[model samples]
Target chain A: MIKLQLPLTEADVRQLKVGDEVALSGIMVTGRDEAHTWLINDKPDNVRKLLEGSVIYHCGPVVSKTDGEWKFVAAGPTTSIREEPIQADVVKEYKLRGVIGKGGMGPKTLAGLKEFGAVYLHAIGGAATLLAKSVKKVTDVIKLEEFGVPEAMWILEVEDFPAVVTMDSHGNSLHTKIKADSDKIAKELIGN
Target chain B: MAFKLNKEKFRDAVLELIRLTSTELPRDVIAAMEKARDNEEPGSAAKSVLGSMLKNVVMAKADSTPICQDTGTNIHFVTIPEGISLRKVEQAIIEATQQATAEAYLRPNAVDSLTGKNTGDNTGVMAPYIHFEEWDDPAIKLQLALKGGGCENVSTQYKLPDTSLKAGRNLEGVYKCIIDAINKAQGLGCAPGVIGVGVGGDRATGMIMAKKQLFRKMGDSNPVQQLDDLEQKLLVDLNKLGIGPLGFGGKTTVLGVKIGAVHRLPASFFVSIAYMCWADRHHEMLFTESEVSYD
Candidate 1:
């Protein structure tokens, strides 16, 4: 397993291949539908500055605040296909090196990953408590009040956050193969 | 099975159910996961993912936190004896839901569809949605299933004789529909899932039956021999797809496959699947006038 730090260089992402297990360290911003929409519609520089060379996690975390300190109670990856329309744009606009989510994005996003040196990391879906253990702290938050806890773009500092490279910068996607194989098998099983 | 519901403690009992269901997965699911883990090649991604998932399950139980952050929807299937005041029970559940949200046993999942705003309290119109069943037994039985949104998105319904797959309105067609649905779901519904299927009912009833099948404990067989056989067959077939945990591609795709059939009108043949994630956060609480026990 390779260990990659935040603010990853194109070299770091390009070296990753499909099926490589990785542990990410440093900061990652949690962004779901609301944040992605805002990023594409507004193209705000404030958030864009934070995204350069970093990963955007598709997560809606259950969080709690204790004495003004934010903590992630449960944090797991959400489905990523919904972001397909905007992912390529997000990667190009933000200079994103990686996207952390479950369920790989579409060919558009895969093309974007190849064009811009980035990879798609598949986090363990529904492994919230275990994943939250790696989040060191919530450094900051955006749109908390307007979007609510789950939708808010949480700026998280993490250590050794586990994920697997399902989609590589070279345009190879484990999802593509698994999906095709599963489709063929389903056809055979309908007869099996 | 014949008892009274201690109305005074009913809300508290539901709250306890919420906490337990949220933090801990039932024993059967954990065992299935363990078996899947053991079945996988050592040091494979599927094994590692299952390992972390099991660790998360244990930690959430020990720490009293939600097993999954999404904590999807709070679906309650309540069975009560005659003369029971369902309205009062509904009020109590709403209160319990509010308390659960504050305690963090559930996420505020109720979103205003039009406004795009969070309800914050996990309560809105029909939120914590309760479906009531009347039973001869005097005991009040409450079953809670907290389904996550990711899995919910992948839940699908089919109109059979699906020409694309050359499926007909028979058991064969049902098998085809199910297989096709799982393929489309891939890991999106969180692989290593539990599939609850309803066949031969109208759209509404089929979906209802499908979801109710989820409450049946993981290895329990359907009363009807044919459905039982179908369940067994689909369970084996789905895992063979090797969707693994979170669609990582491994031998254990589905933890359980439950199928229910109802009589349907000739005009409509709908098969609905309520695909559940591996978390499978469901529990049943038996309430009497004096005490409450959970399974």
Candidate 2:
């Protein structure tokens, strides 16, 4: 597994392949539907600056407070396909180096990744508690009051956050391959 | 003498049920996952994902945290004795869900479909959706399932005898539809998955009954002989598709298959599937006048 740190360089992201496993460290931001919609509609300068050269995770975490400090109880990836409508634009506009999500994105996002030198990292879905262990601290939360908990942007400091690169800057997409392969297998099996 | 329900007791019961089901992967589900893990080739992505899922269950339980971040939509299936108050149960469930959300057993997941607004409390119109049934037994039974959005998105319904697939209106047709659905899902539904199938009924109830099939234990066979045979056969066939965990190619794509049938009009033959992720969290509670017990 390759290890990555925050503020990933274009060269760093470009080196990834479709099946490379990665363990990310440093700062990252969590966002989902509302955040995506907000980014596309307004493109806030401060948020863009914060996200510059950083990984964006498609996640809605279950967080709790203890001793007056917020902590993650569970944090896992939501489906990334929902962001396909805006991800390509966001990646290009923000100059993001990496996108971490689950289930992969569509063609538009793939094109954006190739154009902007970004990679789509696939986090394991449904493994929330295990994923939470990688988050070192909750640094800040943005748009909480506006988007509510799940859709809020959670800026986190993480160490060794694990994921796999399913879509890379080189135009390789594991999702596309798996979908076609599985379809062929299904057809063949059903024929018998 | 008429039995009276205590609102506080019911609310507490609901809250506890939510907490337990959210944090703890049911034993049956764990067993199936472990079997899938064992079945996969060593060092494969599918095996690694299953290993991670098993570890996730342990960590979630040990820390008293939610198994999946989504915590999903809370579906409550309520069976009450005649003369009991549905309003009281509904109120208690709503209250329990709010409390659970605050305590972090559930995420704030209920959104306004039209407005795209998050209710923030996990309760909105038709949220914590309830389905009612009347039973002769004196005890009130409530079954809760936490369904994550990814699997929910992949769940599909089919009107069979699909000519494109050469599927006829029979068990063979149902089998084709299920394979087609799984093929379309391709690890997107967080396979190895649990398939809950409703063989007949109108659209809504068909889906509901299909979801209800998820409550069955992983290895339990359908009571009906034909359905049982189909369930077994489909379980084998789906796992052979090689979708694996999270769509990473390997063996052990589907963990279980459950099928239930409901009465339908002659003109309609709908098969509804509720594709449940590996985090198949569900539990049941029985409330009597004096006490509440969980299964």
Candidate 3:
């Protein structure tokens, strides 16, 4: 039941722990597979400036434009593991305070969060349509005209978005904990 | 004989199916989650998470919106009857997919593998990869499945040896392979999901069968009693692992187990397992001239 305002400061991110329920409100940048590749390879100009101190969401939303105004149809969380190879680098380079996605990131991202003073937030995986309502406004978009709407970087203003802290700056990850516990149980059940 | 389907009607149906699927967690999935919530003995935390997931499904349905943001890559498994011309049907499907892509405002999931170019439209050269299986029946059955990359990423295939030991054909070897895949995947594929098993087929056939089996409705038993029993056994074994909803740890990890088998050559035994995430968007329809239908 923790209420958090996004574009979170380093100090604010430090206080969060794994398994904390958070309702976030602020500006978050949306990026999926493509944008991540660009950030990792090219280090696009002004990217750091755009995302600095902001939360990055691993998502590709379904959005419709009517009368030149864009509206979200379904903006659900994408699996965070896809970006694990580059997430830590992206967070450090951009000075990002948080990441919002479904599932969870790996050891590298968890370590990066600890080193960079950040947090990884897990949004409800299947609640795409409801999540869209939290996006108050679309600030801007980039690099997805040809890729269609999903791969675009949609800068958005959000309000009271919900998430759980699955990874913290202390190198604690909820995903790892759950998997270890599950595996132990699995091994016992299989009588190994 | 060639039957022409109205392109606009086809487009509308695909869009509607996507919309419906996005907003609602199918009945069986809901039931499985509810049962897991009740049966999970770990603690109140896991139960609470499952409870919210159920509530989220209800809200998504009530609002007529997508349950998750990842709408997934739209997959169409079209089976045409022998003697029917498929040119028009194929053309209609491609056109309908493009139109639905625009209408649903679906995220452009298709991308060039090598150059990293994203195809604006969801379709490209062999994009949907329609496999035409000639059936003896006069009617055509189309199964539409929207597969998210998370679950797709976890799909695995193993080529088993021909040697059989004392304890049967070594089916445990296949089970172990699948368990390893699920283990390596961790929570990435979205747990509390279904695993589509394709056994006893050629490599390509096994893979396709695994993918196609995902279109089967959740909770429906396999037509063959043996396969149905195996499915039940697999379900129980998978859930016992404690990789609950979203892999957060609980009693019910898999909603169901579906196995589709085809007799293969005596020399080889190939197994393919495809995983489907919680946002399982799929529907079946029978296309006939009398009345345009949707499931």
Candidate 4:
């Protein structure tokens, strides 16, 4: 397993292959549909300053506040395919080095990853509480009121946040390959 | 005669159900996950993935944190005693859902489709969706299922004889639909998954019934013998696809298969699948005039 720190270099992303298990450290940003739309439409300065060469985690975290500090109750990845509509543009525009999500993105996002030398990391979906442990602190939260809890872009300082590279910078996607393999076996089993 | 509801007690009951269901994985689901974990080759991604998932379940239960961040859409199927005001029950659930969201037992999930606005509280138009039916019995039964969006996105509905797969309109066709849906889901639906299938009914009811099937305990057989047999058979067939946990590929692709049938019009044959991720969060509560019990 590879251990990567955020603000990853293009060379760092290029070295990753599809199916490489990795643990990410340093600062990362969280976003979903609302934030994606906001990014593409507005290209906010705060986001560009924070997102350059960093990973964008597709997560809407469960958060609780205590004494004015926000703590993660549970934090897990949301489905990535929903972000496909704007992800390619977000990648190119943000100069993103890695995209962290589950369920994988579509062809457009994969092409964007290859073109921009980024990889799509698959976090374990439904492993929210476990994932929360890796989050060192909730450094900041962006657009909390506008996008709500799950859709808000949260800036997190993380340590050893685990994920697997399912879409690599080389234009390879484990998600696509898995689908094809499963489909072939399904056809044979069903005699189609 | 109608049984009067104690507003505070009912609200507490719903709140407790939400907290327990959100924080804990039911025992049967835990067992299935454990078995899947044990069946994998040591040090494989599937094994380690299932290991972390099982660990997450344990930590969530111990810490009283939500099992998954999404905490998902709260779907309630309620069977109330005759003459009870369902409107009151609905309001109580909605209120309890709000309380739960504030308390962080649930993530606020209800969103406005057109505006992309989240309700902030998990209660909005059609949020914490409740389906109510009156029963002759004296007790109220409530079943809640928390379906995460990742798995929900991959769920499929088919019009049989799916010509693309060459599946005809029969039990065999239903089998084909199940396998095909799993194949398409791959790791996307957060496999090892629980598949609840509804055969018959129109599109809407088919989906509702399919989701209802998930309320059945993980290993419980369908009351109908044929459906029971099909459920068991499909479980075996799906695991053969080798989709494995988190789609990394290994043994044990599916955790459970549940099938239900609804009466349908002669014109349409719809097969709907409610694909549940390994989280598989659900619980049931029974309430009477004096006491409330949960399982």
The per-model lDDT (C-alpha) reads 0.91, 0.90, 0.76, 0.90
DockQ of candidate 2 is 0.73
Off by over 4 Å in 4: none
lDDT of 2 by residue, B153-264 (tens): 9999999768888888798989999999998988778888899999889999899989999999987878899999999998888887877899878888898999999998
DockQ score for model 1: 0.74
Candidate 4: Cα lDDT at B240: 86
Candidate 1 CAPRI grade: medium
TM-scores of all candidate predictions against the true structure:
0.97, 0.97, 0.90, 0.96
Candidate 2 chain B — worst ten consecutive residues by lDDT sum?
Answer: B1-10
| Tens-digit lDDT track of model 2 for A63-168 | 9988888898899999989999999888888878988888888999999999999999988899999999999999999998888888999999999999989999
Question: How far is B199's C-alpha from truth in model 1 (Å)?
Answer: 0.9
Candidate 4 per-residue lDDT over residues A1-192, each given as its tens digit: 899988899999999998899999999999988899999988788778789999899998999999999998899888888889889899989999999988888899999999999999999889999999999999999889877888788999999999999899999988787777787888898895
Chain A TM-score for predicted structure 1: 0.98
Which pairs of residues clash in candidate 2, taking residues 3 or more apart in a chain or in different chains? B187-B247
Root mean square deviation (Cα) for candidate 3: 3.0
Writing each residue's lDDT as its tens digit, candidate 1 over B173-228 gives 88889988988899999889999999978888998899999988888988999889
Q: Chain B TM-score in candidate 2, rounded to 2 decimals?
A: 0.98
Best by lDDT: 1
Q: What is the lDDT of residue A123 in candidate 4?
A: 91
Expressed as tens digits, the lDDT of each residue in A1-192 for candidate 1 is: 899989899999999999999999999999999999999998888987899999999999988878999989999999999999999999999999999999999999999999999999999898899999999989999999999989899999999999999999998999999888887887678774
Report the TM-score measured on chain A for model 3.
0.96
* Candidate 3 Cα errors over 4 Å, as ranges: A146-148, A189-192, B1-15, B41-45, B134-138, B161-169
